[model samples]
Target chain A: MQKTTSSISNNISFTRGVPALEALPTTLFSECLQAVLAGPDGKTVLQYGHNGGYVPLKQLLAEQYHVDVDQVLIGNGSLHLQDMLTAQLVQTGDVVFTEQPSYDRAIKTFRRRGAKVIGIPLALDGVDITALEEALARYTPRFMYIVPDFQNPAGVTTSREKRQALAQLAEKHGFYLVEDVPYRTLRYSGKTLPLLRELNPERTITVSSYSKLISPGIRVGYLIGPRDIVKPLIALAEDTTLAPVLPTQAAVLEFHKRGYFERNLESLKQLYAPRLQAMISAIKTYLPGIDFAEPEGGFFVSITLPQESNYQHLLQRAKEQGLLLTDGNGFFADHLNAQANQAHTGDRFVRLPFCALTPQEIEAGMQRLAELVRA
Target chain B: MQKTTSSISNNISFTRGVPALEALPTTLFSECLQAVLAGPDGKTVLQYGHNGGYVPLKQLLAEQYHVDVDQVLIGNGSLHLQDMLTAQLVQTGDVVFTEQPSYDRAIKTFRRRGAKVIGIPLALDGVDITALEEALARYTPRFMYIVPDFQNPAGVTTSREKRQALAQLAEKHGFYLVEDVPYRTLRYSGKTLPLLRELNPERTITVSSYSKLISPGIRVGYLIGPRDIVKPLIALAEDTTLAPVLPTQAAVLEFHKRGYFERNLESLKQLYAPRLQAMISAIKTYLPGIDFAEPEGGFFVSITLPQESNYQHLLQRAKEQGLLLTDGNGFFADHLNAQANQAHTGDRFVRLPFCALTPQEIEAGMQRLAELVRA
Candidate 1:
């Protein structure tokens, strides 16, 4: 598989959940880097920074999020914060809850920290509340992780009513809620809802990043939470990396200060919204009757295959046709209490990320996928 | 103490172990960032990079170290790699060993991971071989961490003979050695010794960073080791941060490719060498008969206070004289096997880092210390 995959050339990949290359503001980044290097705090950017983050960026994020400076802690990436949180809270045999078909790396991170992950199935609007309540009654999770806005892979955004219920559930269960909102600002059509932290400040830790908005290469993400959690995480980060990268953080701050983020984000939406529309229309035209909710915003659109269809065969065939698709099994989690392995949880699904592809490319890829499914 | 320390407007201190601001090549960094942004791989620099590292930088390091590229793994900083290694290997009740006066953060990181850290006392040349051997005989440690080149807080470089012996002992006892060499290239005098990895590549995991030579703010460090260790670390990094910061990594690669690193290293040595000289000379002139070692290179010069003198009192007095100093006790590890706490192990020592201060400031600081000691 590795050999065959590597041998293929000129392939169109839907595996990446990254912004388009054309969407990156290279000139703006260069200008930001230059400005930051020439700025008053130039030397500070080249030296070891505060363990929690670059201070100016923290202040900026604090103001933007309406939190005190002490409540905001920055990291290398949002996943870095998630990994640290898992390390701090979860131990061997501890239970963690995630949305079914969640981000695979988060699942792997929690499991690596020796936690048993039980993924609750997600409805079109949000994570299934009934299944979540049943799980809550059975096990007390250290934390529940969710990408509330434009959830990854599944492309499901939680409704306002579900968000309120989830917040109340967290309060009753006494478990922390990790509200990851990497795709919050990228909404193209849907109205924005209140953040989970706003609904339940006591039990919510909000994680967001400049990756989706500014650039992923800068590697700046932040966690706004209670000081008790933030302080220990600061110590952990200090022990690990001493501090996050400051030069890029300063560059990001300069970009934000120059009001480039808003403009860049607007251009990004313009660049991506049409592609999303193309993907949905292509799915309808090529793979009619496929079960997948249309995402209002975000990078992905996952479709469930018929029960008899094997995802691996489809993936390999797609690769042969120079169309790369992400396997869905990786997104699902093993049950904590199951005596036997649940091997087919996400095997009958496939994820296609629309952000990195053009409308034409998305159409072509879907056409190729439909041919494989019909075969 | 916090209020008084914060209230002071002016202070001459030896607490920080970072490069002098004057030595930072801000202009060169700007040029490098600009060049990288305009280079052929410009778009790649703004996207999520390989979990292992930016490929060109890894290739450059691999070529420099005379190893395959796969053996090299870049990290946020060298300390990030060290912390990950500790997490992977040192489980609860695990025994780890370090020099008596080790880097404070490394000690804290190991202790936080639930490892019992045994401090091996250091002689002038290096760590006490006799003590290390005795500890090895009693407890098989997960790994022995050493600064090897310019030991942190103590500034003791290992002799060639001691390096060979340590390498041999690692092989004989079947224990790994983590040779951290952040200050390897900052030598003002004395010939360079073979790296521990050079002596025993099989048992040595080398961790070095660009923090000292290039800039800490870029946060690029690397590990060169066997595939087994490097492979798992790459997975862990992916699970955590997805990738290291690609923009900074590309900037560093450009810096290295353009030969700015060599010029920067030369300037840094010129900037820091005189300060080290001043610190050594001041110790002899102002604090005559003080027990200390004259380091050939590196950032620090530590002196042992007389047994009757309390370090807390000296620290307080030093602060009153508008001076800041690091508490030495933080560098010493608590014994895993001892029945009682080792309260006074490093209390009789104070570490002075010369890199951040000017020659004149070093003399002034030493004068103030001498006055406080006499009073």
Candidate 2:
């Protein structure tokens, strides 16, 4: 029975937001590692590096972002950079703002750092400006975290108009805008919108990572911001991790230098675009009772089940049928707080990640969910 | 004048605790990276990893330490593990105890977390037990941070008897012991002492890293503790960095599997022991008025200047003379707090790391220091 259950659980997984196995450039990465280690600066690469990170990687990122080298701080990963940002800025009783259905882990991190996270309801275009303005008027958040391009869980890209409003509001309110662009380059379709940082560079901090564009195992991520903000983060890195992992950073730099980065990103879009299409088709055919906005890019397609549907029950049944899913309740800050208070909210929502699974697997998984919903 | 100043600053540095460049297994590491990427699990290694860490490395460490695999949690680095631990247990106004001249970065980390840090005085043998006991009598700390083996900035090993006493004290007082062992495996001489974790498995968390043993640039470290503690740390890691860097962890595992870890450690001792000896010899010959406990192993030799010496002036003059010294004041938590309060203490002490410098460089640096002392 246990063996059968284990095998059943291996049937399909839509819970991961990682790149598909076919999308990872394993051989290219190995070559990049070799190229880096055989370079003239191999000895320096192997030694303890500067707290800011590998200088050349910082330089590369600085050039690309049109920022000074000092403005770029390479971290273990962008998530690590977010953790440091919270540590640097948040204190107990502080307020932070995020989209209503935001990335679960970022919400957890903010709350863990003792911030009362206020969620601004998200619209198809972006966060509802009216709701955000009302919250901003009532409380001054230390920072507002926005995943503007292909936002996680919701898969809704903030519109250019929303980005402009956010930039203006941030400037007027005097709160930092933390623009996390981890999925910016993963667009399968849709026109690129201006980044909040590009819109308001002075009050914005942009965080991104190679986890998707490059192999996640490389764990190279960076933050570009004002020099004053980047400086303390570097000091935090020094006291905490000493330095970012250099060999991997060197390998990433080598990969970029070899001009494989753009090509790999193009390949990733090609590989994932079909999977996203498969998910949309499956949802249309098999999940008629579900409501969702079709995403043009990124890994996730979030849906809201029928008002009468019991999502917790559906989730349990889906697991029994070997359809792995990311639970919807975790994506809301207020829902999490309600959970701790022995209440429940947002249980009818679900996020389906399409990048890590094949079209066939996605079809089968959605069919299983359809049967469970009908039953 | 700027170029001359830059050249002088580059002459001799004693501020770093990194391994000598010659000691790094650069070629071996590259081979291991290639080997791991060429292995059957290469695809999985490049994908997002399990939150606990790369599994085989944990298994290897578990077997070596005689603990269950669940008890071990690999981190970005040991300092990162320390950061997680402090975040998990420390609250604002919580008490944390450390050696009077503990690792300066650690003191900064704990203070940054809003812990009211109390420094236990140190003797040549370890933390002064009487001072620790007195502090314990007055307040309960969330945890006591100890670098038992050749403590950083002090180079004093805690005696086995003191380790036992600490274990007992922790059990009686009901506080955790965060036993950091970054320099534990880098011992160039002396008998290996029992780890505090071995003495009291229930209350002690052992944090060690491969930065010194393998290579600092790899940034692999781990913590072994009770399941409850390790579990939360893993969660924190998940919410923060997602997972530790996998390529480097896989390389470390491959390096171990290929049976190179021991030989590399042996080579590291051979490379560093002579440098330690040279520093000790120079201290005795050139700066006779300075008092110090000669360390048998680890990266540093800490010395106390004569009472009449103005260390701030000496540090400035040393910078001008092309001699770099780690300022002593940063090591003391009370001293740091005093500085914020417009007072200063612990300026008489200086920590000189010998591992990154050569015997010749150590000799020259010590001679420069001797000249400064005389002046």
Candidate 3:
């Protein structure tokens, strides 16, 4: 599948979850990297760093997350943290829960570890609480993986009520809530809800990365969890990558220290907000029959076609027109196994990412998509 | 154990395998990094990279190693590569064979994955062939993990004949040979030997990293193996860190393209050679009774105390006198489990690394170590 995607040329890709290339603060990031290389700790940055991460970076992250220093464990990226957490908690055949259309790579990670993943249907506002409770009661999974804020493919933020309910449920059921908040800070609109960690500190393990917020290529992220769980993870991390890349860590720390991180994030919001708005408007203008909830922030806008629409055929037609978007069937676990109702519903959905495309590109791409759908 | 080591300060550290800070080509590296940032592909460097790694870097490595690009998979570091390989190959309760005194961290990774590690004593040339054959006969391991080039903590490189024998044995026995050669490029003196992969490409997976040769903090490494073995590892890597840090990969690619890598490596060789020589000379002059095999290259020179000597007590005395080195016992898998003969023999060894310190520090530290051993 990746090979097929790579073979496509001269196509506008709405499938990737990356930040727009035009929007990346490359010049400023380079300056920060150069500053780190010229600094007093330059030599130290070239050596093997602490397994948990560079202390200064951890301290800065601690302040931002409003957590103690020990709570944070740095990784190559949030994906690496997810891998570590899965390795630590889930053994083969152990049940793990996730949203039906959660992040695909994460589902791959959990499945690779041989965890039996059960996906609960996601409501428009969040995870379906009743279904989640039923799954929890049935399987009692090792952890419930959730993307509360602008959940990846779904692009729906979990409501405040659902967040609290889920957190309370985790505590009540004695299962950990793995809150993946990579897109949390990218809120272009709407008031922020309380974090799962804030709701149930002891039972919640929050994972976030600099990939979406800073730069994906830097591959720096952190896991904030209980000390007992985090301690073993640090040891596992030592055995994994030994540590995160120190020069990148140093570069990010310098960027934050120079007060560029907040400013850069603000600039990103300005850059992406309108592109997202353009996508929403384009969807409404062209694809009249498509159903989608307007996403306030984050990368994706998922559109469900009419029941009669053949999404795979439409996708192929759109590809022929040189626009690449993700088929929603790939996002659902049950679709892979050909589960009847879930797979049927999955065939009607397609995810369009607004973050990596220009506003013009978004509009044109959507036009092409709508043309294919209409045909 | 990590905490205990971190607490000891104001001592000349002979335990670390990292390259000397004074010798890194920081200015040149910084320039290369900046060049990459300013280049046309700068935005691509900040975006998510391919799971296999940046293609140009892989091509460069492929040319250097005389392998196809698909044969190479870049990782966060060699340790990360090891973890990926382990996850791909080993299952819980699987047997894994290693040198009696192997790299402690790799051993930890294997053990943490629930592989029962069996240690075969290493001869002056390499792993004792007799023991290896006996172990193979007794149990079929998932893989034989070996650091053939300047084996960590032992500083012994395998002979060409021994390399061929191990590779042939692996093929004959129908098991894989995992050759870890992080220090392969750091040869200060010695004729190059045939790599394990060269002898038995079908049965050998060679893992090497830039950590020792270029910079550990950048955390770049590659695995060259059969495509079938590598394909699964690539999927596991995607599930692991998604990909290696892209900015560092770009920086390294730029450095290599600009021909700074070879120059920097030459500089490192020049810097480390004399320090290694100084340590050898100091050991002869100050610690007369100690036995050690002179290493032609790489970081460590392991010393074995006289049979009656209490190495742990001597280590404490050396620490008190401001010299810190790794206890060789930690390197042996049997030591952790209190296995008799191997554990007892491990107690008599200590490893001193010459790469991180200056010639003066090596001499002074060795002298202090000699004084403590004499007491």
Model 3, A225-258: lDDT tens per residue? 9999998999878867786688888888998888
Model 2 lDDT per residue over B113-202, tens place: 779998887788888898789889899999999999988988899999999999999999999999999888878877899999999999
Candidate 2 on A107-222: residue-level lDDT in tens? 88888778999888788888989989998889999999999987898888998899999999999999999988988988888788888989999999999999988888878899
Candidate 3 stretches with Cα past 4 Å from truth are A1-10, A312-317, A335-344, B1-9, B312-317, B335-344
User: What's the i-RMS for candidate 3 in angstroms?
Assistant: 1.2
Better of 1 and 3 by DockQ: 1
**Residue pairs in collision within model 3:** none
Sort by DockQ, top down from the best = 1, 3, 2
Per-residue error at B211 for model 1, in Å?
A: 1.1
Chain A TM-scores, candidates in order: 0.94, 0.94, 0.94
TM-score of chain B of 2: 0.94
Q: Which has the higher DockQ value, candidate number 1 or candidate number 2?
A: 1
Docking class of 2: medium
> Lowest lDDT 10-mer window, candidate 3 chain A?
A1-10
lDDT of 2: 0.84
The DockQ values of the predictions, listed in order, are 0.78, 0.72, 0.73
Best by TM-score: 1
How big is the positional error of residue A78 in model 3, measured in Å on the Cα after superposition? 0.5
